[model samples]
Target: MRAAVVGAGPAGMVAADRLASGGAEVVVLEATGAVGGRTRSVLLGPGHRLDTGASWLAGFYSEALAYCSGLAMLRRDVTGTPQLVVGGRRYPAPFEPGVLARSPLLGPTEKLRFARWVAGVLARRRRPHVGPPRRADADRADRIDADTAIREAVGAAAAEYVLRPAFETMVFADLADLSAAFVEGWIRAAFDGRYRVPAEGMDAPWRRLAARLEVRCGVEVTEVRPQGPGGGVVVEPVGTFDAAVVAVPAPVAARIVPPGVPGRPAWLGELRHAPHVLAYAARPHPDPPPASDVHPAGAGRHRVGSVALYPGGDGRVPVGMQGATVSAEGWWSDELLAAGLDDRALAAALWDEGRRLEPGLFGLEEATVLHVARHPHAVPVFGPGHLARLAAWSPCPPVALAGDWTCYPCVEGAVRSGRRAAEVLLTAGR
Candidate 1:
């Protein structure tokens, strides 16, 4: 059987791999010059490369971890005690009960309320599964926004200072813009395992996977149509295939996919995405450079969302110089994009915000901007009723859809979506 996979991101690449493993001829078409879609890593300097896209690999990313098993993986030591900055104060924000008891980020009463809420969510937590969540999982929480649920359960201070920053850093969207069901799932999944990154780079695994496949880069697929009953054709560089998988972002998929495709969602074009801006910088470090990552929220006039530090020991930096990637808040990133600032100016702005958030640590007066990455569709926002909509959607034989937007917004979601899409095609072909 012949298959075509569009968009060489994690989902597309994984689908191609699965199709090939099933003894099918597969061709992957990527619009960009590179593979690894949002997991892209770029050169920092002479002998350094930094991940400007998805950086950390959670313990729950089973598929991604298995795909990169041949490469050397380094356990990230910074996950143990991350710091959260709120109201110009820094507090240790680990998941430990003792740590939360002593933390001044929330009052005693608020902490009690937050703890009860967390316990309730955990008590009702279900086992981890792939694909979209079932409709049976929907409840009153699924109908409300995360911000409202959190604030009501655990006062405004706890919501703003503790929960909001941590979740926002993960999804790149404000709590008010997300569904309570999505946040609850993330809460249940949080701290399940340690965090790690590839010694080569975050994209190392995808690059290895791509090297073994037939990938055509710099090729834009204009249209995908069902040729007959169980066959499809790709328009640009037209070719007939037994099956085709559209693995790009939802907005792009909506534009390329013609009408009358089976199992296509009516609201595919209405999906929303959060914009992201990341600025990479390098400079000589002071003795014992900032070891803790900084997450700032609910602080007025703070544009920077988080500052992730690379302390040179990892392959992420040269010796004696610390590397850091500063990301702007989702809302602020939209504003930055609208302002139309040049790359240098944008990098400077992000760096300045990082320095202000951590004056003692990010005091790199002479830091050099390595690169700036801007993603217009960084992550899919799972607002109220979004998950239920996905639960009811499924792929057909000739044409299938696969992406993180089809599931949760993470590497795991992308991997699962690709595998599911390939399984559907393989089954139909048989």
Candidate 2:
């Protein structure tokens, strides 16, 4: 059998790899100049690379990571101490066992509420109730969206600390739009395993996967029409195949696939992508406390929110700038200049320690800025009545759907959906 995979993102790559490995002739069509879609690494300098997208990879991604490992895409360590600033005070990362146990992020009552909520979710998982399949042929074991957000399901408190301030920033979306059930599962998974990143860059794993397959990059699949009954998909700009995995972004898939295939939710399309400006600057300040000892950032913290530094051993210093709290208004740059952090002092820090490791962090005589403004609709936002839409949408003939947007907005969800779609197509082909 022949299969055409659209998009060349992680999900599409997974689908293509699976189909090719299964003895099907696979052709991957990607719209972008390069593959990897949203997860591609950005070239910061002449030889320096930074994972501009999908920087974090958790150990919970067993299936995807294992596939990459087989392809020999080495995994890299990205662990570092996370410093949280609250009210101008710095604390260690709060998600840690110790921080969670001692920090004020969760009040006693809120913590008890969280415990009860978690217990309820665990109880449901233990019993394992299955809803009607989204597709007639979908697996009976598939779980549908579970009503589980702190704001909508519980109250304001859970939304205050856990959902709004923390998870929203972490996931790069507002809590109200995300699935509470999904978050619950993610938290559970984290407790069960550790999170890591790929060694070379974020896209290294997918790149390795594509290396073993026939990938046609920069080819946008303009249309996907039925060749005939059981004739498979006719993909424009790439010819036809016996089957096709429409694994691109939901909007892109929606455009290619015939109607009835689930597109992203309107609210998801309405979702706003917050702007993240990562500035690599130099400061003569001493090394801050370790993340293991600091508290999570909250209101009144350093104007720079969500800053985590990872010191690369072997004489290289790399610190990640993740704070997006206040707008371009009153930033630390002004304060630093006002407080008089001499340009020379800061330059010494950047060139001596920072440049040796993250060359991207050096030579900041002027403000070195990299701004990332993702489309609001870029990531799927699991919103009200999301399950209804998922249950209603159908794929165009021979063009099954996958991606994080289908189920949840995470890499694991994207892979699971892609694999599920592949299985569906492969079964039909057989």
Candidate 3:
């Protein structure tokens, strides 16, 4: 059987990999010029690359990272000498678990309250060796909104001070719109988890995977339609295939798949996403460059969600260059993003915000490298009834869905969904 995999992101890559391994004629079509989607990495120096998207591989992504000998993944060990800049006063942010007891920033009462809330969540997620099962889905009456759940579980102060920088900025979505279950799982897994980044970068494995497959870059799939019952599927700008995987982002998938396809969701056309703006700038700075993360939430006026510094390191720097990447808190509105992408001023505004976010500890003034990217449909937003809409959504005949939007909002989810789509086609074809 022949299969067409759409959108050459993690999901599409995994789908093509699985299908090809299973003796199917697989073809991957990517709109961009390269393979990795959000795994897009840019050349930092001669032999270095920095992942501007999906930077880390969480330890719990066991199945996804199993191949390529852990995707050159390494367990990163960061020292607990953490400093948090909140306005004029910089406080100690405890990263190590037990070190929290010695934290000078969090009051005893606040720490106790936060601990209790965490304990409650961990307890809920815990599985007894041989007891009744727990439903770990993202939908719970009390977990529809992350901000409300965090505030109710711990306190408003905890949500505002703790959740804002750590979770909100990292996920690129405001806690109010994110599903609490998703956030809880993200935090719980991160704690005590062995996080890894590729020894070189996140794009290596995808590039290798694409090398063994028939991947056509710069080929935008405009439409996918069923020929009829018992007939093949047509992928515009590509040939017909027995089966296909629509692995693009939801918005793009909505546009490509024909309207009124059997089993398509009424709200499939109404999917929502938060845009993303990632900026990387280079400069020459002194020792002890800056804190790893500097969020603009409590800082002075800034439009970005958070900024993470990347100083000159092994292969990360050229001669005397240092760089920083910023993720917008909640990107410009959809209408604004669509209208403002071509606006060079918009990119300038993002770069200026990156400069403001820097602590300026080393008197780094000149930036040698400036790269700004805007993803209008960056992260999926799971709001109220989102699960219902997802459940109602279905692919057209001989076409399957893939991508993070089709499952959870992460690389692991995308990989799992892609493999599942391939399995569905394999089973049906057999």
Off by over 4 Å in 2: 43-47, 70-84, 92-101, 105-108, 111-158, 260-305, 314-378, 385-397
Candidate closest to the true structure, highest lDDT = 1
In candidate 3, position 335 carries an lDDT of 38
> Would you estimate the TM-scores of all the predictions?
0.93, 0.69, 0.87
lDDT (Cα atoms) of all candidates against the true structure = 0.81, 0.53, 0.68
Better by TM-score, candidate 2 or 1? 1
CA error at residue 117 for candidate 1, angstroms: 1.0
Candidates by lDDT, descending order: 1, 3, 2
- Model 2 shows how many backbone clashes? 20
Which portions of model 1 show Cα errors greater than 4 Å?
A: 77-79, 126-131, 135-139, 286-288, 299-302, 361-365
What's the lDDT of the predicted structure labeled candidate 1? Answer: 0.81
RMSD of candidate 3 to the truth, in angstroms, is 3.8
Give the C-alpha miss distance for residue 229 in model 2, angstroms: 1.7
Worst 10 residues of 3 by lDDT: 127-136
Best-first order by TM-score: 1, 3, 2
**Candidate 2 local lDDT, 1-430, one digit each (tens):** 8888887878888888777777788888887788776677766433335554566667657666775674324333433234444444544444554565676766777666766766666664443211212452332122332223454455565555444444444454444454444455555554443556665666777888888888887787888767667666788977878878888766666666665333333433443323232233322223423222122333332333343333322111234321111111123233333444354453342234323322223244433433332222345555444544566653333777777677556676677677777877777777
